[model samples]
Target: MKRAAALTAAVATATVPLLALASPAMAQQPAKTAAVQTQVLDWLSLDALSGTALAQRVKELLGKGYVPSALNVTNATNPQYTSLWVKDTVGKVNVLQGLSATDLPKQIDQQVKSGFQPKLITGTGTGPSAVFAAVFEKTTQLAKSQLSMSKETFAKVNAEFTAAGYSIASLDVYGTVEKPLYAAVWVAGAATGAVQVTLGQTVEERGKELLAKTKQGLQPVLMAVEPGKLYTTVWSKGSATGLKEYLNLSKLTYTLKSAEMKALGYSPKILSAEDGVIASVWSKK
Candidate 1:
């Protein structure tokens, strides 16, 4: 079960260029730090777990052990799957989980077009930091049943999105023991621009090529891998504004535990600690 616990962590604050555009809200007396690490732990825990009770599984993992620092994605892709990744001294693991706030499929497009209410979580953590949007949470779908596809299959999948009126922003295909069988795509809003593979490196001489690609104004938010598989997500400016943002996990704390850091000395700028997860950014005291 632990072998399935693949996850990812932010590439560190300096890696993302958009943090330069911190809204005035973050520039107050004490700047806010994004909750990056928290998300990583959650993503890892979900993969290490199995069964039907999503909440219980999460609870069990939290109690076992994890750091609370960063983001959480809501209404990601289809509720049939939610992405969570973690990394550490051992290795990197990314998970595609069939999870939801409620027991129905997530229609993310409709939610965005209508009204999107974020699911708020609370609990314990390392320190206190402001709540932030999960770095990148796109609509991702993993096959319900194992399936395989050819290079033509990629073309057909792209066509399906085009016909539906959405564009393919970024996608990574997965395979079983031999052929490419499953994939998850990050859908784009505009069909006009191009998602270019500007940066790339061969993962293996003949096996695969992992690259950093970008389109619109979005950046590659997360890159995760599990043995022979990989998953990546890219994003664009949601609002007309050109600014892009990503969470940086500054603190981590666990449930049934008291804050280990000096909570009183530092002034809190951002805070979101609930349901066994803790995220916060504090001002220099």
Candidate 2:
């Protein structure tokens, strides 16, 4: 099968400055039902946190339903300011801890005041000890009996990645809108040598390929899944830096990439995609 052109770019390098912020620790709750994952954009934050601290916080936030559908982390060293990917819930909320306290709030305010159409602002850089997390927020499950097609689709995607010299580091499910989607996060091969195969593909093309798998004459509508897309974040241990790409939206990627998204922040694009298939959005901070 002919492949879609995958976009590729290298992340820049920077020395990670470590800074810590103290916020009221969120209370934990019972685990929610597992559901599918969806990709979303329209959020950007300057989270000042410790990576280990943030990791522990993620587990709790997901439990309490803070709405961090999915997030990513950056590699850093004796990090002064560690970039944390926190969970967020549906609706308007300030997911970042002390970001607004800084000039960041004014930055957000000025953007709206000046009408600066946002292109790409910035996210946290990294250090050698940097850890990149391709995290998916788990929400309460909807569909009881698992769909047969879900397993099959995962199988096909797995096979392709294996052939491409990438392996699944983790797989998870999360709830969204009415139902949910799956998230298959990967850890790449060492910088020693990697297959030149495409790492990222357009979501639309991926959907078609998924439908065409096994030559089983599978109808698209049977799995005409809602809210499905592809996303990935590539970071270099050698450089302790990374680049995140969250594109191939069922809708236009450009729309999600907005300052309004930065201010309103992200809340999983599931509501936007509905029952459609979407790849949960990722970040490099």
Candidate 3:
């Protein structure tokens, strides 16, 4: 069944201070022109797709030069998949679904050794029975990456890395409701400008913060939800122009809003689900 979507806009109010560190690689970018960047049209967004259906869809997308950039599994026990697929340069890509906790690490190591990077990792369940779903790509632009860290450890590492001139491109959370593990992909050629993270916030609280942060020029890069209905959101620097986001919306509202945004020349760049509620970020083309 199709679902509805929602949309909201925000204005800048405040700013968050971030360390000014950029690698030499980051400083070599060419100047930008006034012309708007070309809008990407070859993409698909899935909202609460069933596991069985997702398997077939994944195969189809891979053959069409599309890859999953972000993924989440709602209702971990039953497993409903949500993901964002975007067209990418043709290269080797792999997807692993529902791998046991013990096996996930080993498999990730194997893939990394084989010249592939885990582009996205989503875990479900907790403790010994937790399972992970990952997408690996051979043509990744990552400089350094880490996965399977506790909340406390991630904070420490995030601080250290930010100071060392690395910016997080993506983050994934999984495990128990009280203590979720985090995985992040780091790139060296970027600045960790103006970062904000909200942990263990309720859907409403996170939504409010998201609005405020985006109003202050911070864009959400990742939003993770726990079984206990808590939300963790990570934000980094982004232009308020051409950006809009919606959070904690029902499937019907989400679908409706998505269509409205599409008609206005916007595309969903981020999509994730938790306990049947959806959160998404749409950017103007």
Candidate 4:
């Protein structure tokens, strides 16, 4: 999701420092005049060029007579704007990257210390590539970091999976790891069915003990779910035996709708039971 615009306080903080550093005489001068504004417009015309082209264009503008204080650009289409601010003085420039939702005062302080008065600010976000292009258009500095997911502690559970006979295929650390989440594993023989297992924390803790009990209880009815099929399962708040019973009934109903039943050239009546919770099984006529 896009972030909101930076707060005004952040903007002020970023710019105030540099503005304060001007010579006493310069400090006494009035705010930017119309002539300086005109110069800024001439310099900012470089916004037309995007990506590397824009960066090169900025260099060209700088080579001419344009002294860019700051250039701010944001994605117009994103509900939350991703902004890029660059402050330039003499030949030195510092770029401050922030989301529109950032505190403006902090941003201003940082910008001021970096030099350059705030100049051009624009927004554009029409196409997918445009967002990235606009953000990276004027310079080549990038930072990368990883974010962790916020959820109940699952570190111990992850370790347990390793300790068990399951091979971890992939772990997505950016989201919750509970039911409805997809995680692949390499199991032996019964791997054909796209069977999603929902194990409660209690069951997971018991591990093999629970597995053994389930195997004994469902030995007669448990069938292999089709392999490689994507299925979703949830850990319902109920007895383990009851959950297995529901799955068994669901599988039986699914069997009635299989290709084999259709090959008989007969249409069967299907109905929903328990408010569509349980699918009713039917035989071909």
List per-prediction Cα lDDT, in the order shown.
0.26, 0.28, 0.65, 0.26
Model 4 lDDT per residue over 201-252, tens place: 2212333434654554421111111111111222212234322121212322
Residue ranges of candidate 2 with Cα displaced over 4 Å: 1-48, 52-64, 76-157, 160-259, 262-285
lDDT of 2 by residue, 153-226 (tens): 65566567656655444333322222333334333442232212122234555444433431432211111112
lDDT at 161, model 3: 81
Best by TM-score: 3
Better model by lDDT, 1 or 3? 3
Candidate 1 runs further than 4 Å off: 1-47, 52-148, 169-172, 185-188, 196-218, 221-285
Cα deviation at 198, candidate 2, in Å, is 5.3
**Model 3 weakest 10-residue run by lDDT:** 18-27
TM-score of candidate 2 relative to the true fold: 0.24
TM-score winner between 1 and 3, please give it.
3
The alpha-carbon deviation from the true structure for residue 82 of candidate 2, after best TM-score superposition, in angstroms, is 9.4
Model 4 root mean square deviation, Cα atoms? 27.2
Model 3 per-residue lDDT tens digits across residues 1-285? 122111111111222221111100111233222222334435556666676677777776665566777788766677777787666645567777766667777777877787777667777777666656777777555546666788888888888887787777667676767667876766665564778777778866876887798788888877776556677778888875787766666666665666556656676777766676667777788
